[model samples]
Target: MTTTSYRTAEQIGHTEQGPRPLPALGVQTAASQPSLVDTVLPNGLRVIAVRKESVPMVELRLRIPFAGMDRLHAARAEVLANVLLTGTERRDRAQFDTDLAAVGGDLSSVVDPERLSIGGSALASGMDVLLDVLADALTGAVYRDEEVARESERLVERITMARSQPSVIAREALQKHRYGDHPFTKEMPEAAEIGEVTPEQVRALHKAAVLPRGALLVLVGDIDPDGAVAAVGGALAGWQSDASAVSLPKLPDLTPGDVRLVHRAGAVQSQIRLSAQALPRTDPGYAALQVANLVFGGYFSSRLVENIREDKGYTYGAHSYFEFTKDNATVLVEADTASGVTPAAFWETRYELGRLVLSPPSESEVDNARQYAIGSLLTSTSSQAGLCATLVALGAVGLSYEWLRDQPMRIADVTAEQVAEAAEKHFAPSRFTGIVVGDADVLAPQFRAIGGVVLP
Candidate 1:
């Protein structure tokens, strides 16, 4: 047997299909350019406006950093987000929808884990009217008790449906197992908790989470930045609240050698997820780890896909990622395979991980992976909506366009040594936490042969 060293980089050269040409970093393509102007309001609402002359329509996204509702005030934030569109003081539900439809405009809202977003699109000519209506709905929503009860029932039904799905069950189980007692484990409230949500609770939550200080407004398409700010500011001027600062609990330390399995009967395919604690977005290693994950399992031609899908044909697809965030982060590998082939798939995943840890990727592999990452970044910025969304997400993460403008160089600068070092640090097999959802009798023996198994 040939002794393979994991420390040395492999000698694989560029494939028959050579590297794709990198788009010139300073290429003046119309599609790659963004016309965004940033400003701040007196009350501290940050506005990002992008001018798109081709489209006659406009899209506006309002992001309120009231994610606190899900943790400290769960029911209240949820109900307020839902009730905002139900009706407002100036317009009832019917009139609201009618006015929007008359101008071919539509409004929608969602309360995410970290923010409440209200978004809509309309003809550029009707932007002022659309902004007014959206403003009224957000700042003057009437959370009537009857509406709250009705919405609560709807939420309960939705939660019940989510529980019925096996994939969701496995995902939720993984979150609970990984996070343990952390608030991230608590998704939707229990039915009893939903039943106890009162109108007063919704009001208080609205007061705390919907304040202007913790909000971001992104507008795209034909619109004047100054005019748009004035309109939005005028609408939200009356919205006042003594909302407190958002404080997040320290993330829990993830223990290695923790394995969790959830068995679901009558399942045709097994959902396997293995993860490890990882670095946050602020880490200097983020860019390098991104390249490592790409070569590992993030792309179609990645190592995981090449090993599990192309070489072995055990699963449809397998991939891994690092969820880079400010307070918490995790690296995960997920895939679904046939019940009979689950064991083989799991071991193959482990084997590939071990290979990456032992042997660094070849120079050509590193170049290809870097090129793919940079290409994707350019593609994402090609669309107006995608561009605006990227800006909004960067802002949320405390980054700016200047940072994004420098990403191409950063990705290109990543070397084979850096990718190898990142793999060794983040993808160590000994630190892995595996979660498999399948028939235990068939899977347990194989898992036990590989690593210890914890069943639930």
Candidate 2:
């Protein structure tokens, strides 16, 4: 084609693939990683501080381990998170909101089986006020009856809607398949229990589970690390408790087994969620396995998406990711499809899983995946919000700023052979147990033909 005949991408932007294979990626250079200052206050709270002067804003992340004694605990904890900021002992809900808004700040709370997280942000100059407000809430949340009642009703409505969704049903069934009756399997509480919860129960949970002994706080912004630490230490001096926080117990290793068919009565679609045990970030081979996951199903250009979505058109989307727990991690794959095509989609998924382990990915595939893994991390951490969030997660796994700074080089150095080895060890179809949530009448016959499916 001559230059005169060529058209811009706006005119002809489709099918950029060439007839020949693409070249492998070469070495990558990155900007200098940021410096971090960290300290553990005498009260045993870990504070991580980083100076990012690019923006005049500050970000805060706090994670506290929240353990429940029984299934009822989930319901109570959910209510507590919803109302923790509604009314402190001194300020009413409206006043608290107004004060935070005055400083361009906001705080929100989220509770799960693993932990209770409080994420907030403010202007750089309002940093001290934000910390003071957080300290006040920690020490003196009132959990008023009227506020609790209102939030409780709203939570029940939200949960009921969530429980009816196909994705939620599939996720709940998958957790059950993996962990049986473990407390972690209960993602949402029973609506009836949530309705019965009183304000008193929430206060009790707050007393028992919201201690600061094992909490992690990550602060990033355009502030001096030394002064920020001192300010935080002074503000939170009274937010201490004698009782130690309870961390979740270590989960048992994932065992590969038969597929389970969960019958969703009269459903027109199916959700397939599958998983296998995976290495944690601390593992020596984790970086390579991350690259391997990207090549398999972690990205749009992956082999799994190519075979299942683009080629076969079995589903609109398919995604696989790693879920990290305090004790371990697992690889998860999920896709939803028409009820009639569910069996074909599941078959292709398993076939791809087997093929990933049977043969190594091409050199070009390895290079693309490796670069994606490295590049995404750099882009994510360039902002204060992103860096602080990443810091909170890394701290949960006992990693530090040095680890985050070195990850790009580690990912860039991963070779095709390393990714292949990690794939063979972790991606075998036989090593995964999965669930098919759809009409049993439509799915049972097809799943039975393939064998290894247990009916319930």
Candidate 3:
């Protein structure tokens, strides 16, 4: 038998000097602009249709501004989303699934504090069927008592489980600390509140908040753009209301303060959440800020990960990302570590945040971040589903396909100096405040020694 000789994995991965240098990122190029139509129906629903023929399937996303100010709105809204597709006047739950499955389609609805979203997919040949089913639910969901009761019980159980998680506990503490009692902070409602949401309340909410006006519908796939818009308009003609959907009230501005140390009794692990106000996507400074953010901690290779995770072994992972809501945006840095390492991780996180502001990024670092920002954007939109989701997000902020088509050029245009300026202006240590959730008994001494944390 003849055997082929081969190098071991370690041998192939290194050179005499050290590990091999990574190849420089290639010249970034823009994707070809897709054929598209964007128009508002007479009933005030904006329809965006883009023809992406990569696959013989279509993806759909519908977003309605579903914000409400009442204290119990979250609970009611969650129930509504859970049962929205359970039954319509035209079809019950079984029939609804049967009809969509017959056309190789499925749809799901979810709600957050800001909006109610419906997403679905189907073979391109069954696009019409998908739209029909969506329309049937939007215009005719009955909110049957049995369906409401069933979903409520299930939702309460889920909420109970989720609230027990350390991450959920940390997030709740952060939101409340940042924006006290704001409707937007109530992302997950109380289980007791969910248990009390009656079917009549859900129906009332649907009738009042599920209006077509001010909502957006996006469709991307192997279909004619113009024809898709026409189909949507025809199918949803009955999903009309004289009033527009409810938008969340503007969020209160965040202020810098001492980080709150929240006590989670009996917890052995800890969550550190840090946040600071940042520019929105619509801001002219956003591109430069985006690059700076990537360099700081937005990706696995970022400085925070390299420092706290790779070097110090303080946490398994660390990340920083922007959270956008309505017209406001904020950057959040997060890490989870054992109770013993939590204080060290928090200190290093704060150090890195300040370092980005004072030291800024080197020219080489800025270039790498720029390449990553542009490349990730291109990769995210390379598929039909991705493009559809992107359009929905951009549309919510009043941007269109043209904005997306030109985003690469925008990222590429950012200079190192611009990125540095953004870093200094936005990422100062004094600008951030957040929470650390852990066994305070274990963390209080170290955190107090560190001097910026407000212990419970």
Which candidate has the top score in TM-score? 3
lDDT of 1 by residue, 406-452 (tens): 77777788889999999999888777886889888777777777765
Please write out the lDDT profile of model 3 over residues 92-175, one tens digit for every residue.
999989999998999999999999999999999999999999999999999999999999999999999999998999899999
Flag regions of model 1 displaced more than 4 Å: 1-34, 68-72, 244-247
Order the candidate numbers by TM-score, best to worst: 3, 2, 1
| CA shift of 270, model 3, Å | 0.5
Q: Scored by Cα lDDT, where does model 2 land?
A: 0.89
Clashing pairs in 2: none
**Model 2 lDDT per residue over 100-134, tens place:** 89889999999988889999999989998899889
> In model 3, which regions exceed 4 Å deviation?
1-22
Q: Give every collision pair in model 3.
A: none
Please give the CA lDDT of all the candidate structures: 0.75, 0.89, 0.92
